[model samples]
Each structure stands twice: as structure tokens, then as C-alpha cells.
Target chain A: MHPAGSLIIFTVLSGLGFGLLAFLGAGVVLPLGWEAFVWFAAGYALAGGGLLASVFHLGHPERALLAFTQWRTSWLSREAVLAVAALGMMAPYAAGSVFFAQPLPVFGAIAAVLCLATVIATSMIYATIRAVPRWHHWTTPAVFLAAALAGGALLAGQLRLAGGLFAVLAVALALHWQAGDRRWRDAESTPGSATGLGRIGRVRLFERPHTGANYITREMVHVVGRRHSAKLRLIALVGGAVLPAMLLALMPASLLAAGAALGLHLVGILAARWLFFAEAEHVVGLYYGRAAA
Target chain B: MTDLPETTDKKLGLVIDLDICVGCHACVTSCKEWNSQGYGAPLADADAYGPAPEGAFLNRVHSFEVTSEDGPPQLVHFPRSCLHCEDAPCVTVCPTGASHKRAEDGIVLVEESMCIGCGLCAWACPYGAREMDPAEQVMKKCTLCVDRIYNENLPPEDREPSCVRACPTGARHFGDLGDASSAVSQLVAARDGFDLMPEQGTKPVNKYLPPRERDRATAAPALEPVGEAGGFLGWLDRALSRL
Candidate 1:
């Protein structure tokens, strides 16, 4: 739960891009015009830039090409493979929409499905983690999906859609926050379970394995200051869902207002994503003698 | 390719006895010495002589104090390494096919050459088992001493994990757990060895023997007086009986 900057940017921005792509592909906006071109361009740029930024996280970026080959089992692999397929399908959809000013139902349909699938796959990368108790829940995907759609709707200038999605996102976020906070303190694994000492009463750490931090401690045992996390969670709620909903509701057709909403929503989503990473409690932390986890 | 085998022929793993392990870190040291120049990457240290040393280790020993219902607190030395689970989540989560389970022996391993160093395998492991080697930029874990155990160059008696062989108290054990009649399995059955974090459902092959409680009531014998039933002895005995 290091909350690496690259991942935060990648998940949030790509989520927005994919959400916009889905809306545009379904012709939910309108009859097709120059604005549609701008929307598609911006969407792809966000998605593509986010994807490109992800490479920096890898120590051996050249070998990242191999990650796409394991889509059968790995969620990360599935994300890699589905991202490529979705992006590839978006090429013709973008070109035809921008050049001919005609929305092809076939390309749009394929791109729409792929875009949604890609987002689900991205969320599954963390949601499927059995070791991270906070993330291992049904609400994880629901929150991710709702947040992406809400962000995408705002970015695409669909005020009504953004408003509705924000309401849904707010509900999802509330549910996630309630469940997440409860599970953070009450993880099923205990100190006894961690070391297999439950048969005896009151097991406690007398000594740690080492004085200095190892990979497990350094990577898995990240602590978020409670006050800071609470503040950030509030910011995520207000900026991500509420502020955008307010802005879009008051100034429905204003391009400037839409831009402002997207900016505020981005900041909020970034903070939410950061919290998502920071709050994740890996089960190994229990072994480190932080038994409260 | 990341799929684990339907069944491994022999589930070879370790059975560490918590009752006998004295937290001496013999296994930790021996594992480090033998693996420093291993078949895989060297167990490298970045700042050995510095104020803080950051290094990667496959096995570590953690000591804990647990108080039972009947007695005072006791120190429990727990050695943690890769469990080499039957349903190894690390193998399934690897984006690359580098992290794998050996079909023959059920030893979970990482192919250094193919590893991308993403650390996803480490994230998937709940036991704090998979450790990333910062020097090699790949995940490293207990291979159950695959190099030494199968090496014909060594003597038959020495054909075991360095940790198991180095333990002075013989608390560390290594054998085929798949066989019901194996020495390790029998020991597990006899000692009522239990799995760590059974809720995780990894079905880990490695088991830990809980510390046996010492009997305080029958431990010492009663002392007899040299002169019975006389003078001060009689008066003291009558007073003690009255109290």
C-alpha cells in the first residue's frame, strides 16, 4: 500500500478515458460533430498517456511486453491484454467519428465493451488480492466502476449523465468507506493466526525478526496517519462526487464549468486512489507485531 | 503456463517445531550463508557496514511471548519462509510465467531470468514469504534447498536444507509431506501440527508444532524432615495444620 504516484495517475486517468469512450461509443451524447472529435481525442490522450506512464513503474520496461501473454490467469496480464485490445479497437472508432462525422455502431459497440472490460480488469488487479483484506470485497469493483463512469461523464460534457453517475458514485463511496474502515481494524486474521499460536492464550511479539526494514516490512507495512487519511477521504468525497455534481447541476451547458468540474474531480479521484492504496492492510503486517490489524 | 499442476508427486516441505526452537537464528544464518552464492542470485547486502543494512533474506525467525491459561509467558521462536502452498496464489498472480510451482516436488520457485521484478508475487503471499531481491531486481524465496537437497556431490546425510542441517536442537525438519507414512508427516500427526492462517486457504504445506506446556504441579518432589514428630517439628506441624 505504498500509493505509488504512477499507479494513482494510471488508474484514475485511464478510468476516465475508458468511461468517456463507453459513452461516446454508445452515441449517448448526440448526432455527431466537431465536439465529438475533441472528446474522443481528449479521452484517448488521457487513456494513452496513463498507459504510457505505467511503464515507468517497471524496473525492466522492455520486458513489460511479456506481461500481456498471461491474460488467462493473471489480472495484471488481463489488464495489459484487454487495454491493448480496447485501445486498438478505439483507433477505427476515433478515426471514423472524427473524419467522416459518422458513428459506426459496430466499432462503437466493440470499443464500448472493451473499454468497460478493461476498467473491470484494472480494478480486479487490486480487488482480487486475497492478502489485502480491505481491498478483497465486492464493493471494490463497484466503487472503481462508479468513480470511472462519474469522472468520464464529467470529462465528456454530459452534465445530466455526470450528475447521475456522481450520485451513484457517492453511494458506492459511502458503502466502501463504511466497509473499509470496519475491516481495517477487524481483519479476520489474528496474531495467533499469523504465527499459529492461537491454542495458547494472549500471543504477543516478544522480538521482531530484525531491527532494520526488509522488503516485507518496507513494502507491506506502510502506515497512513489517521488524521491525514480522514481529511483526504473527505476531500475525495467533496471534490470527486459532490463538487462536480454541484457544478454540472448549476451550469449544465457551460464548457468552462465542465472543465472546472473535471479538474476538481481529478484532484478528488487522485486523493481517493491514494487512500485506496494507503488504507489497504496486507495480512503480513500482522506478523510484524502490529497485531491490531 | 502459470497454472499449478493438478498434483505434485511429492509435497516436500519443512515442519518447524516451535516448542524446541530456541530463537537462536541458526536457520536464518545458515540459509543466508548457503544462499549468498546460490544457484540463483547472491543474497546481496547494500550496506553491510553502514548504520542501516538493507538486504533480502528468504527466511527469518520471529520470536513471540504467549501466556497460556495454566502458566506464565513463554518465548516462541517462529521461523517463516515460503510455505510452497498446494494452491500457490503467487504463481497465479504473476503477470509473467517466472513464478512457478515445481510439478514434481511441489517446490514453488521463481525463474530469475524470466522475472520482471514487478513484486506482484510478493503482494499475493500472505505469510510475508516472497521477498524481492533489490540487487537482482527479482523476487527471491525459499526453494527448499533445491540445489543442495538434490545435489549428488554431497553426502547422503547432508542432503537436506542448510537450515534443517544447521539447527542444533533438530527443531527444523524437511521431508516429503505428501506421504502419510513419511517421518515429517508422522511427526506432524503426533505433535498435532497446524497450518498458519488457515483462513487464507493457501493450503500451505509447511506446518508448525505448537509449544507444549510444562507441568508445574508434578515437576518437583516433596521434602521430608530429618526428625519427625518431636519438639519444634511437632509444634510447627500442628501450627501449619491449624493455618
Candidate 2:
């Protein structure tokens, strides 16, 4: 829950990139020749660059290929496999569109579904972690997919679709925050229970094992200032959802407006994603005497 | 390979007694010392001699104050490490199949060679059991001294986890918990040893023995006047009374 910059960039950029690819594959918009080339390049860059950024988060980036091996049980593995599959499948469709001006409907449709599946797999990596109660909810995936769809629509210049998806994203984000706020308490993993001292009495941490921070404390016990988080939440909502939705609704045909909306939305999503990791209260923090607020 | 075995032949784990552990951190230091040289990777420290030193440690002792209506607050030294759960979320979350549970002894371990160090396994653990090594950038956890536990090179008495061997108070017990007749299982049954965060449903193999209740009654006995104070005490008592 340290809110590593690499992961924040990876999720936000990849989500948007995949979202755009999904729309493109669905035949939502068809650009030909040089126009198609620009569109495909942007999509691949966002998606590929995001994937590349995620590799930086790994301690052994060279061994990342092995990550795709355990798809049977690991969501992270599934995510890696799905991402490669989505990117590989989209290649031919992108080539055809740029060269022959053919949309390649069949490949586009399959690639679109794979693109969405890849995003879902990415979300599932966090959603399945029961240790972080805030993330272990249906709303996690809901918010992720909503963000992807809305951001994708905005990038594709599909104002009507973007407007609708933005509304859904807003609802999903609200629901995710509302539920996440209560999840730690709902999980009932208090310091007493964590130490198994609740049976006798109330337990309070008296002394930490070490004087300095360790890996667990650095990774899992990140404490965000309440006021800071509140402001970020406002930025996420206003910039990510409200402003962009308003822009799309008011200036439905303005390419400049769409570009501005996309920019604001990315900033908003970045803030939201930061909050997503920073606000997460891992159960491990109970050992360090940091109560989930 | 990340999938857990249907059943492990043995559930080897630790049973730490909160009643006896004094938070000495002997086990903590010994664990780090033994594991650094014994197993996969040396426990790495960043800025060890500098300010803001951070390191990876497999075992740590946390001191907690427990207060009850019947008695004043008491300090409990709790040692935490990998529980080696029957359903370890850490193993299943490993992206590279580096994290795996032993079918033979039920010791969950990371195969360092395959570790990508993405840290999903650490996130899945609720107990803060796994720490990413600063130097190696790979996950480090309690191996239960796997090398020593089965090592023919060591004497029979030393064939246990370094933590268990280092504990001065004998609070740490390591054995096969799967066998109900094992000393650890019997101790758990007798002392009402319970899992940490049972709600998480990891079904942890490691168990903790709750601290025994403290005597709340005053230690000093009430003073009673003898029929007459004797000798110097009597004279002093009479003198004080007169004053």
C-alpha cells in the first residue's frame, strides 16, 4: 500500500490504453492510413508503456517472464498472461488498419474482449487480496472497469459513450469509497484479535520490535494524512469524473474540448489511484499498532 | 505449482507461549543470524549503520499491554512469524511460482531462483510474515529452519528452528502439529492456544498460548497487633503511642 509510482502509472495508463483499444476494436471509430497510424500508435504506447512501467516495480525485472506461468491459481500471473495475449492479438488489427485501411472486424472484436479481460485481470490482482480488506470487494473491479471504459471512451472521442461511462464510473467510485471506508472494521481484525489477546482483555502495542522501519512497515503501514486524502478525493472526483463529464456534455463536438477532458481525466485518475493504494489499510498494520481508521 | 497440496504429510510449525516470552528478542536476533548464512538469501539491511536503517527480518517480537477489568495492565511479548497455513494466501498469490508449500513438512517457502519479487505474496499475508529483502529484493520468510530441522549434520537437540533453540525461557515449541499426539498439539489443546486473526480463515498451523491470568490481590499482608509488642519493637511502639 506504499502507492509506488510505477504501479500508479501502470494501472492508470494501461487502463486508459486498453479502454481505447476496446472501443477501437469494437469499430466505434475507424480512421484510415496516417490517421489510423496515429490512433494505433497512441493506443500501443499507452498500453505498452504502462506494461513496461509495471516491470520496473519488480525487484527482478528480468525474471518477469516467469510471471506468466502460474495462471491456474495466481491473479498476477493471469494478469501477465492476459496482457501479453491482448497486446499480441491487437497487433494484426492495428497493422491492417494503418496499412490497408481495413478495420479487420473479427480480430478487432476478439482483441477488444481480450483488452477488457486484461484490465479485469489487473483489477483482480488487488481485488482478491483479503489481507487488504478495503480491496477485497466487488466494487474494486467495478471501479477499475468503469474507469477503463470511461477513460477509453474519452480518448476515442466518443462523447456520448464517454458521458454514460463517466456516470457509471462516478457511481462505482462512490460505492468503492463508501464500502472501503467500512471494510477494515467489518473484517473485525482488531489489534487484540490479531495478537489473540482480545480473549483476556484490550491489547495495545507497547513496544515495536525494532527502532527503525522494516520492509513490512514501509510496504504495508503507509499512513496518509486525513486532510491530504480528503483533498485528493475532491481532485479525483472533480477532475476525473465531474469536470470531464461536464466538458463532454457541453462541447460534444469539440476536439480541443475532448483533449482537455482527457487530460483532466488522467490527472483525476492519477489522484484516485494514489488514494486507492494510500487509503488501503492492510491487516498487517495491526501488529504495528496502527488502527484502521 | 503455486497450488497447495491436497494434504501435507506433516504440519510443522511453532507454538509460542505469550505467558513465558519476555520480549528479549534473542530469537529475533538468532533467527536473523542463522538464516542469513543458512538459507536462500542473507537478510539485507539498507543504511544499517546510517540513520533510518531498514532491514528484512523473518521473526520479530512485539510487546503489547493487555488490560482487563479484573487486573491492572500486563505486558505480553508476542513473537510473530509465518504461520505456514493449510490455506496460505501467500503461496497462491505468487506470480512466478516461487512461493510454494512443502508437501512433506508443510513448510511454505519461496524458491529464490524463480522469485520475480513483485511482492504480491507479501500483500496476501495478513500477519506481516514476509519481508522483501533489501539487497536481494526477494521475499524472505520463516523457513522454520528447514535446513537445520532435517539436517543430519546437526545434533538431535539442535535440529530445530534457530528461534526455538535461542529462546531462553523455552516459550517457543516446534513440532508436527498435524499429529494430535505431538507435544505442540497437546500443549495447544491444554492451554487453549489460538490462531491470530482466525477470521481471515488462513487456518494457521502456528498457534499462540495466551498469557495466564495475573494475581490481582494486594501482595502485602494486613498488619495485626500481637497481644503485646515484644522487646525493642514493643518499647518503640509504646514510645510512639505516648508521643
Candidate 3:
């Protein structure tokens, strides 16, 4: 709820990384009967590498295996289970595709579904918490889906033969930008409403109980300036969406150009994720006198 | 291990009289003294008798002056700590079963050694009762002086918590709420006692009795002064009063 940059980056980055891997694995493993397995392998391996990098960000990565135990109640646990399942399906698919000269359709389809579900689960984990007003909205799921779609498109582009999927990526990027805009506006409106006071009323911080910054302030009341936020939004929209769309349309269907576009998109996604955290206000922000407008 | 039940047919809880509480913070000091020495880890204070002292105190009395349309300035002294809820969210959220509520007497407690400092229990509570001991990296909260209460060495009458004993105005009361005929239960039934943040759905067991209303019949109207000049005694009396 405090919108920690580390956590936001972890979520968005990992979503892209894992989503791409899953998509690549699905393409190669599933019986699309694609000409070359090398491209699929390369994309899947790259995405998997990103996924591995993201795990280091967790506070208790050692306890992640225990995450599966609470699947009955916690979506986090379900996500962990599905993540392992997807990876497991991919392992055999990768082996069969490269070495055995055959791809497993059933396993690939299951892995693809599981990967999508995992992303949804990850999104819901943050969105479900009632304490965070900005995240506890319908737009959260859409953001998650868009991130995955964009990541999948990047991976598809890396494979280049499946360049047509870039259209899907372009659409997803547009949707993400629109959703981000709406969420920013909604947050601005709602933050002002958090104090349970009207626009005309003036509230001042005459006294505070604690002299030193407490956990509440450190964890909940992170504020970002309007100018920087707007700039970041612009960067994300252009770099993540518009440019990628152009590259997908105009460029020779070469893996090198597609890779560049994907890299640029990832950079844009980083900016977007940063803004998502920096702009989104927590309900607890009211206590610190940071209610919206 | 079969041990004797701490309270035989008793579910002891607190009944706080809002009218009598002056918010002196004596109860908080007594609780810290009793609990830290007997049951749990010390309520460690940093920089005591120096520049800044920061520590965990088991009980805290907050002073707030509320002004209502129908009444004069109402000073509400809210003493908050752990409510020891019936549906304790802390226990349910504990991943390692470190926190639990007793089925015998309904006392919620934590096994400090077992706590991994995950901070989930703290999030579950709305009262801000649970605080993490930074030194040990474990969650700590009020134990209701469990060690002092059940000790056989102390007399039967001294078995109650230190906060209840140290209350100057007799604002604090502790007894079995489970027994219908008990004094605390009877007092709760007689007066309209309410729980703090009932909408939180924690179902806290501790009850606060509302401040009693005063009768208007005992009040007298002030007389209007006749002139600006007054006698020497009256003038001296007014000056002394101001001084």
C-alpha cells in the first residue's frame, strides 16, 4: 500500500519476465508446428532468466516453497503452485522440442493457461487488500493483463516469425496507457476524498504525536510530484506503446529490430510501474494530510 | 502434560469505567513493571534518562477533548491496549501458530521464541496493540500478566493484573465475564457497555462503560454583577483567585 518502488518493479518486471517465458514455451511446446524451435527456446530462456532475477527481491525467498501450503485461502499460494506447474510443463516441452524433434500440445496449453492464471493471481494479491484504495479497483486486473500481453508480444516479436502477434501487443500497450491515465485521474480524485473533507475545507497539521518518522509514514505516505509524474506517464505511453506499435508495423520482421523494440518497451514498463506506485495514494495517506487534490 | 486450569469456570476480562478514568498513565507503568519482570520480554526503552526514550508500554491512556452540540467540553480518556478478542485475527493470521488464544479462559498470548517477525498479526489488528521487539526480531504484546496471575506464591487476591490493581480511581475492573452471576458480567448487563471499533469485526471482549450524564436540577445560574466597583475583600478575593 505504501507503493514501495522495489515491490512495484518486482511485480511488473516479474510479470513481464514470466509471462513472456510462458508464452514462448507455449508456442514451441504446443503443436503449432512452427518451423524453428531455436527462436522459441531463445525467448523462453531469456524470459526465464528475468524471472530468476526477480526472485532475489523477496524478503523471504527461502520460505517461498511454503507459499503453496495456504492455497485453500491465499491466492499467493495458488500463484506459487501454478508458477511451478507452468515451469514444470515447460521443462519437458523444451526437452522434447529441441532434442526429440516434437512438441507437446497438451502440456503447452496447460502451461499457457497456468501462466495466465499465475499473472491474474499475482495481480489479485495486491488488488484484494482493502487497506489500499488505489489498488482495490477493477483497473488493477486490467493493468496486470496488459503487462502480460505486452510482455508476451515482446517475446513473440523476439521469435519474429510470429510477428503478427505484435498487433495484440500494440493493442495491449494502448489499453495499458489508457488504464494508467484513468487510474491516475481516479487516484487524484480519491486522494482528496480520503480525508473525509470537501475541497473548500482547509486542514492543517498543527501537531503530530511522534517527532521521529514512524512505520506508518515510512510505509504509507510516499508522495510523488505532479511534474515528474506527468513526464513519466508520457515516457511510458510513447516508449511502451506508440513506438513499439510503429516498430511492429514498419520494421523488417527481423529478430534484432524486434529485440530492440522489446527492450524499449521494457524500459517504458519500468517507468510505468514507477509511476503506478509514485502516483497511487494509500488510504493511510489521509493521516499524513496527503488526501488527493 | 496435564496442568491445573488457571481459572476454574472463569473467563476473566476487563471492564473500563470511562467516567472515573483520569488518564494518569499509572496503569500503563504498573503493567510494564509486572509483565516485563514476570512473563514476556522486557518493554525495552532506548535512550532513557537521556535525549530521547523510545520503548513499548503495554497500556496507554490517550486524552481527547470532544465537543458535542448538546454538551459542554467532554474530556474522553481512552486507555487502549490489547482487547483479547473472541475472534482474534492475530492468531488466525499467524503462519507458524506462534500466537494463540486459550480455550480455557480466552487469554490471547504469543510464543515469542516461535515468532519469525513477519508482522502479519500486527496488520490484522486495528488497535495498534502488537509491537515488534527490534532486538529479538519478534512480535510482542500484552499477556494480561499471565505469569503473575497464575503464580501460586502470590496470594489469591493479588492474582489479578497489575493495571487493575494500580488504577487510582477504581476505573479498571477484572473478573470472569463467562459467569452470568459474576460482578463484572452483572455490571456490563446493568450498564450500556460498548466495544471499541465494533465494525472491525474483531469481536473484542473488553468493554467500556459510557460516561454517566449529570442532572440539571443540581445546577445553579450565575448572578449578574451590579457595578464595576467592589469592596476591598471582594477585590482581594478576585485578585487572589486570578493569581
Candidate 4:
């Protein structure tokens, strides 16, 4: 795919946003404190609303509800179902925390699990597609989970943590960056090896079968150079990972400062997400008179 | 036992010969004529008189010239449409179960009513077969002329697919590929056939016979002798010579 910037931002931004909300809801529903309600609601609202915003990137957003209909086979459908499920669980969990008496820790734990389910569902949406070899792997879903959790940890550090949470989140961010980097590298190194071609060889398209660009070419033949990607990675590491970690670590735990730090982290994560799609090479790229690697 | 029972053993499919196909687009024309009037949604053409126009076609023959240092220039005529793979990704991706693979014939079909126009099926396809009808906002592809082939009202001999029937060179064939002993299968086996992008693992049931062996000796059009008196052109030449 051409890797629409809007979609990249949407998935990553919404992922972090919702991920934090789910995590906050988890903390609220737990016996953490009723004082955490505003933070939790704010976080959930940000992420949930962000996720909803991501739908705008789709060509046919009107049919979004039908995305859940194929739960029998589609991972996308599973993701849809889980999104609704998380929303359902969080509404009660949030309500119990706000209007009613303080809820028990179990409530937050349930909300946490529901939030995690949404993350899994989102990840599986890309991972399930067998056609895109770069995406159709175990690492894809793992990477998504890691990024979401990392975002959640960063949010938690920025919001509630008094001392060492920043350090922990920094370490988590570093780990995620490393893992994501390796996945992107692996995807690049793997040549456009189609099925039935057992022995890999350096193959180049000497001739293309068409004159004008076809739909497949337009959609799948996107190429991002190594030099550009390297620069983007640097930006992501600095802006998305290292800087956010430093800001969260150095800054005071006031709502304004913490919110700013969270915002910075969110920007970084979005950049990282965009690079993730950009760096990943599709096998179909080979058909478009380009080297997949 | 003579008049006991009549068995309906029809295994309908498409057989495209890559060699004889000149990519004249006659099949595309014939297909549009049959399908537009036959069934389902109209394949609309946009901007017919304007600078740019787009239209839907069940069958489109693409001409490609594949050249290499190892072999001579090969003009490959690729007629693209739905292959209706047994493991069609489009079918699996459809949310409403609108797209389905027939158990009997292995023909993948879409039920228009259930389709929500998500366009996910289009993304799943590697062949770029499924096109979203802008008018109806539903996915459309080659149905292999389903409405006509089995229509008992049509004459028995005329029941063949329009494309196959219209092909002057006998390049396109329609038959059941499921039966190993069937003509289509036999033809495929006799001639080592190939499918487009088989690496996709769609397991497309449709088979394409490679270009026929060109007899280098007899391939070129034979020319007449310099002076053939009885020939029409020769007589005209003699008259012109006298003048």
C-alpha cells in the first residue's frame, strides 16, 4: 500500500491515545484512588476519540459498522468487535468510578484487559493479511502490542509516577525502538521472494507487462530509499523516544507539564508508526519493476 | 435403461489460450454486450465523449511484449479478469459473506445485496480483478456469463459463453476444469499451462495455455512466384504492362 500519512498517524496516535485511556481506566477501576478519575476520563476520551478519528482515513467510512460483521474469519472484524467490547466495558468501569461509589481494583483490572484486547485486535488486523508478507508475521502483532504498551507506560510515567517511572518508560521506549528497528531491517533484507521460488536469487524486472500504471502498481509499488529511512529513524528515535523520555524524566509531575510531555511522546510515536509502514517492503513491489529489498 | 435418466454434468470454466489471442478486444466488446443486457448491474462508462473515460469490463485483453536476451521478442496477450480462485482472498475478506465460492463448480461469486461496499475485497486481491462499481458502490467481476450459460431457454448449442462463442480463432474455451478427464483439463495437461501470479497462492482454477510453438520455417506468410499468369493480380499487372 502507498502508506497514507493520515492512516499512519491515525493508527499510531489513536493507538497511544486509546492505549493510555484503557490503562487509566484500569488504574481508576482499581483501588488506586478516586482522585485518578479525571486523569482516567481525560486519557480514555483522548484515545477513544483519537481511535474514532482514525476511521476518517478509510475510503468508505460509512461501511465502518459492517467491519464487525465478518468476525467469523476476519481479524479486522475481530478488531471491530473488540473496540466495541472495550468501549462497553470502559463505560461501566468509568461510570462506576465517577458517579457511583469508588470501585474495587478488579474493575480496573477488567478494563485493562479490555483495553489490551483492543490493542491485540488492532495488531491482528494487519498481521492476518497473508498477501502482504511484510505484515503477515508474528512480529507485526507483537510490535503493535509493544508500541501500545510502551505508550501506556509513558503516559503512566507522565501522569501518576513520582520518581523512577520515567526511567522505566525510557527503558521501555528504547526496547521498543530496538525491536521495531530490527523488524523494519528484517523486512527490508528479505528480498521479494514469491511462493514456489525456494532458492532466493537477486532478481530484477527486465521488462514490465503494461504501459500505464495499473491499480496494483499505484497501490503497492511504493519505494522509500534507505538514506531517507535512516534519517526518519533518527528523527523518530530523538523526537519519539529519547527526547520524550528525557522530558518526562526531567519535568515536574504537574498536569500541564505531564500533558505536554505526553503530547511530545504521542508525536514521536506517530512518527515512529509512519516510519514503520514506510520502511516495510511488500513482495508485491517486485511486480512493479522495483526491488522489494 | 435407454431413457431412464438425464444427467446434468456441467463444469463451467474459462480456458484462455495465450498464443492465438491477438488482443483485438473483440471478446471484451462481445462480453460487454452480453453482460450489460444479461444480468446484474450495468457496467457504466464515464466521460464517453470527454477527454478521459472509464468503463467496467468483465474481460479485457492486455497486450504485452516480453523480450529477453535469451529468447526472441514474444508478444504476450494477457486477458485479465476474475480467475475465481478456489481460495479467493476477496471471498474471505467480505464482511457480510456476500462473496462466496460455489461448492459444486468452484466459481467465486458475490451476492450484491449483502455487499456493504467496504472495498476490502479489492485490497485483498492481487490480480486487481474486483472493481468497485461507482454507481452501485459494490464490487463487480467476471461472472463467467452465469446467467446465459445455464439458461435452458437459449438453444442448447448457443448456451456457451459469449466470449468463447465470439472468439474467431478458438482462443477462448469454456468448460469444467474440475474433472481431470474433461477437455479443458486434458488440453491443459497436454500443453504445460501457466497462471498469472501463481505465487499469490490464490489457487486460481482458471488455466492459461502458453503461446503455441511458432514454426520458424512456415511462420512467415508465403509469397507468390514473380509471374503467375492465372492470378488476378498477375492479369492486372499484364494489362498494366501492355498499357
Ranking by TM-score: 2, 1, 4, 3
Interface RMSD of each: 1.0, 0.7, 7.9, 8.9
Clashing pairs in 4: A17-A47, A18-A47, A29-A108, A30-A105, A240-A268, B11-B176
lDDT of 3 at A6: 53
lDDT of 4 by residue, A1-293 (tens): 56677667667765675667666666732423455566566666656666677665454567667667777776666667777777666666667666675654565667678777878877776665655655666666666766676677666653434123434444544555465455545543222232111122233444444444444455556564545766776666666656655665676667766666667666666666776566544454544444433
DockQ for the candidates, in order:
0.67, 0.83, 0.09, 0.12
Query: After TM-score superposition, what is the CA distance of residue A33 in candidate 4 from its true location, in Å?
Result: 9.4
For model 3, residues B127-242, the per-residue Cα lDDT tens digits are 55776664555677878778768879999878888899899999998887888898888888887777765544566777877667643344578788666557997799789989
lDDT digits (tens) for residues B1-243 of candidate 1: 689899999999999999999989989999988988876998777688899988888899998888877877788888999999999999999888888899999999988878888888898899999888878787889989999999999999889999999999999999999999999999999999999999898999998998897657655676786766878889999899999
Task: Give the least accurate 10-residue stretch of model 3 chain B, judged by summed lDDT.
Answer: B1-10
lDDT of each: 0.86, 0.91, 0.62, 0.63
Most lDDT-accurate candidate? 2
Sorted on DockQ, best first, the list reads 2, 1, 4, 3
Q: TM-score of each candidate?
A: 0.93, 0.95, 0.68, 0.76
Off by over 4 Å in 1: A30-37, B217-243
TM-scores of chain A across the candidates, in order, are 0.94, 0.97, 0.78, 0.77
